[model samples]
Target: MTHAETAGAPAGDVATEQASHGKSSLPLLTLGAIGVVYGDIGTSPIYAFREAMAVRPGVAATETEVLGLLSLIVWALALTVAFKYVFFVTRADNNGEGGTLSLMALARKTFDKPPVWITALGVAGAAMFYGDAMITPAISVLSAVEGLELVAPNMSRWVVPITLVIILGVFFVQRFGTGKVGVVFGPITAVWFLVMGSIGLYHIVQNPFVLWALNPYHGIEFLATHANIAFVVMGAVFLAVTGAEALYVDLGHFGRKPIVLAWFGLVFPCLLLNYFGQGAFVLNVGPENVVSPFFEMHPDWALGPFVALATMATIIASQAVISGVFSLTQQAIALNLLPRMIVQHTSQDQRGQIYMPQINTIIMIMVLIMVVSFGSSTAISSAYGIAVSGIMVVTLALLLVVMRRNWKWPLGGVIAFGLLYLVIDGGFFAVNSAKIVQGGWVPVAVALFVSLLMVSWMTGRNRLAEKTRRDEVPLEFLVENLAKKKPTVVPGTAIFLTSDVEGAPTALLHSLKHYKVLHEQNVILTVRTSTSPRVPDDEKVTIDAYNNLFFRVVVTFGFMEEPNIPKALALARKLGWKFDIMSTSFFLSRRSLKLGQKSGPIRFWQDRLFIRLARNASDATEYFHIPTGRVVEIGTQLII
Candidate 1:
């Protein structure tokens, strides 16, 4: 089905003009929001400087080398952040929502069964994002908290404790919701840029020649002078664009215009200045000073304040990534890429402030593991760039499909952007590939596991759905012969759970064959999980009368949400659905799979494992909150 039809948007308005005038202030709000959401990219200044300095192992931190490194930093931001993301990728948002999955959804709608290459690339991108999510908080927070050591040499030992405390505080406050705190996030992030710019400005003023690094020639010259060193520099340059993906992923939270404005108007200038400022500081103070060039940019009196500001900025940066992980999980669920988990909305009005206990716990544990394994920001940085860069390559490939199918951009334009982005992204990927032997495998390993789980869940679900469809009985025949003629007179409502939206529900069919009659009030329910994270509660459940004998109720959930059948039924009652929870019988159809030749090679093992695991699992009645005593289960065997 088309996005508009599925989403219930008006038909003619699907490709209407952008909502510009009515939402003018939205752009400004978006800019500030982008600053907060995109802070991870903005704050790379903390570690990017040190990593770049380490590229040339034996060379002294000379003015020329510093200037050359600064040049590369500026261009990296310009090419990757400005040219690629802000100018190009932002324009490819699917109904203003960005990210690989959204783009893929748009492609599927526009092209209808897009090429396998496109789908594969998109999935790879999504798989890699999981790896990026696991490591971002670790690197971002650790780098920020490590600044404390600049104030007191002995305080270096306190970095981990302080970082843990700050992280705990951040996650603890999630229940209060981000709406209240999100209002200030933009302004705080804005100030962060200002502080970063101001410090960079101070250093640049002391060493005015640093401005010469703006020339691309300096970067090329640096590479020519030290070819071997330049190869290693890719790893460092990769750090400069670490958070670039967030810009596109968060396009929905804020519009494209504001992000564009912020990137060009404020963020771009501040980042370039600070990077050059770091270079200037290093040039004057030398190699030893490179360890803490950012801190040393300020006076002795301001060191404490500098550390405080860095801490806050880092926390905000990490918070954005953690929240993003939640958002990604929600999207994955909506697209049927993962199983439904409990997704609690934290706010009454804001749908974005959602809590997923399963996802939250998993991320927290993975992040802690990353911190313990890597031990410092520098080591984590090695793993960080590789995952993000690989994902970008995947995103670019998908974007080409979007341009052709959705935007109808010329083949030439699509090809041009595709080739250019691939080159830049592919080169970075190759550079990061070198680090795989040096602790970079961590994120790749994480991505592989996530990909396996995602593939397994999707494959298993499809197999089960097919089995159920084949075994299902026709509703009209059952209602006429078995249910209508019988005088069994079953009491109360019977809620039969079925995976399909149409046809006779399997549980109801089974009930008729065994018990010979349907309940007085029967509800055939199908729960649909949407691709978006949150759906309006009022629109959560859809009800229709099926020949006065069966009520077809489909409960929809955002990927980031859980399905509480009991609570949904309660809400249904408020909407005039008549069913007593105490008296209603919840019937679920359980499928048992026998290994056979019908299933695909990739899914044979996965389907077998899921069948065994699902059989011993708690019945849907318990999982969905149906009263235990009123629940019934019917099993069916299928050859996969």
Candidate 2:
């Protein structure tokens, strides 16, 4: 069934059921919500203070600089978090979901303008996020583990091993799934926040002056007095906003209210206190103590407890990113921006809980390499801010488009907010760009590889599908033959794969040409994968019963998803279509593109490489779950 067919289906229909329930859950939905959604922002304290301090050139950890940086952090939280995300972007959610892609969906729906630029920018942002995701685990865990050296200097050697073990254990637990471990996430994260706030209060009592940093003028004065230092300070301030994107991404899971409450009520206060605490620690103990201000706040006897808490927090942070990777990949699959891969749902009730073996393994390899390559938190920090800042810039750009198209905000208001955001985010991007030569190349390299693969698969799929459409059998010819010749009847339904919206598909033409007959019921199915993850199952399969003879069902998946045609056919059975797997004849057109002619940015070598790769890609039979013997492949030539 096509989307057009399912358009009017009621809420009670199987495909539309999920869409109807989109608004049902109002409370914080799961235990993982706190840890998954808030962990990244919570862990920002580990490196944010250190990076901010590094920004001041030779300036001692004076009360003034500490206050200045703290003021900037407060304002960043207000503008980027409070005003932009909470008040503005949160309302742009597509059916109560948020992300770059979700925002893109809203933009495309509201504006008919060419969205290629929007999508391109979104992809770049998503690609850069991979870098952030990889380094986040490394830095968060490494920074916490390095606290061992603070308690006993000789324990420095144990940092890498301890961090690696924690990281490996965190990822390994993903297979057991979030359902079990998720129960402890919220309480553990809540405790982590309490610990962060308590430590900050301890230092704040010693130096009440740190509270003055809450003022905006101090930040302005610090920047005015030290312009060069201010420019560098962005590299550090970028860390504070590292997980800002999550606020938008996870909006769909817990809804805007719970997330905002989590942030403004719990997360924000704790983060501010911790940052202030770190400032106090620096002012009282000096810069050398900056390495582990977090642990230093604890009593000598409580160092062990602090380390354990920090370790748990770091693991939770990494778990959040691992799950994020799955979500992003799923989005990519649905959007058709990536090749289909195996996607297994971890839990029946939790639609968001998914596990992709390919993505998991790939991330595991990249993360392990990151740990080995940049052994220390400080070293890994160099590669970190660039990706985060770059992505923020992209998000800002998208937000401008959303404000204009969705909210219909006045041009003046849009420009005012957009320019202000651009200045702040763009400055940070420039500061981070300076690190391109200083280890930032790692993410750039990874983004380049992933982007290439994404672009290749997308273009290749488009070209092949277009070629298949151009060479397909005409529907008029089928109609003509049906009237003139006796219609030979075949048993059951014959499902023919098609890439075109009009006329008889090539598979149908080939079937009729070879067998000289059409099945009693013909299903001209076209699987349309969108550019977002998880098409509302309520609109999953659309069926058009044309005179009870021609049936067309279009099944949609996200770019990071695999299509199961047999499963879809089985779903059709529930809708009153009698489809027998053994009796159903599945026809697939296998297009063979000749090496002679091809267009677009794809070179001949790359085309050849893509064809080779696509051929070996999970077989159509396996991917679609069709009976091997019943499925027939028809080869068609393409001069691409």
Local accuracy by lDDT, each model: 0.74, 0.74
How do all models score by TM-score?
0.86, 0.90
lDDT accuracy of residue 439 in candidate 2: 85
**Clash count, candidate 1:** 1
lDDT of 2: 0.74
Residue 310, candidate 2: how far off, in angstroms?
Answer: 1.0
lDDT of 2 at 212: 94
Candidate achieving the largest TM-score: 2
